[model samples]
Target: MAQRELVCPEEMAHLVERFNYAPAVKVGQMVYAAGQVGRDSEMNVIDSSLEDHITAAWENVGKVLAAAGCGYEDIVEMTTFHVDLQEQLPTFLAVKDKFIPRQDVPPAWTAIGITELTFPGQLVEIKVIACVPDAA
Candidate 1:
């Protein structure tokens, strides 16, 4: 079995310390990132607007991926949790497309609707699984 490595970027150190959970974990070439919300560098939830929140969440996800030695293009599977499914899905999709602009072969995605999230005003949370290339 491959050893598990916790992936926590410096900006997100507060989360790991406060919540006692790793933002992402890397085992071999697979990086499993936890749900990333629209939080700032100080871990404050960004809720100015749906689009802004969604974009921030994606950026947070990107940070976690980078810490795991991965990138958005390396993501093989993605799962999003939305507070307001019908009302916010279209906006979320638009923001998501910007981060993952590969129209040819995009990663597998699943969008889920939820009532609420960990923090107030946090509309969406994104989680992903990336497969990084083996550095020989």
Candidate 2:
């Protein structure tokens, strides 16, 4: 089996100390990130407006990708879980576009609307898969 390198940001040290999951992992040129929610450094999921939660989640994803030596443009796949998909998609996309402005060939995407999430009031979670060119 190929070895996978765990990707954890120093900012999320508290989560690592408590949980068994890495925020993401890198194998060869690919990086797979766990779903990022609007959680604080201490793992407190924020209960805020959808826009705020979405913005925070994307920022967290950015942090993880950066730690894994990847960038937004390198992302090739993304999955989003939402509490109210129908009502919030427009707003979510508006906020997401702010971060991913260039969509010439946007990553493959999947968005799921569910009745609830792990946290009662948490509204959004995002996971990503990205790739970098193999080293020379």
Clashes of each: 0, 0
On a 0 to 1 TM-score scale, where does candidate 1 land against the true structure? 0.94
Number of the top candidate by TM-score? 1
Instruction: State the local distance difference test value for candidate 2.
Output: 0.86
lDDT computed for candidate 1:
0.90
Model 2 CA deviation exceeding 4 Å by range: 133-136
Return the number of clashes found in candidate 1: 0
Local error of candidate 2 at 12, Å? Answer: 1.2
Instruction: Write the residue-wise lDDT of candidate 2 on 27-73 in tens digits.
Output: 98899999998777766777667788888889999999989987788
Instruction: Give the Cα lDDT of each candidate.
Output: 0.90, 0.86
**C-alpha RMSD by candidate, in order:** 1.4, 1.6
Best by lDDT: 1
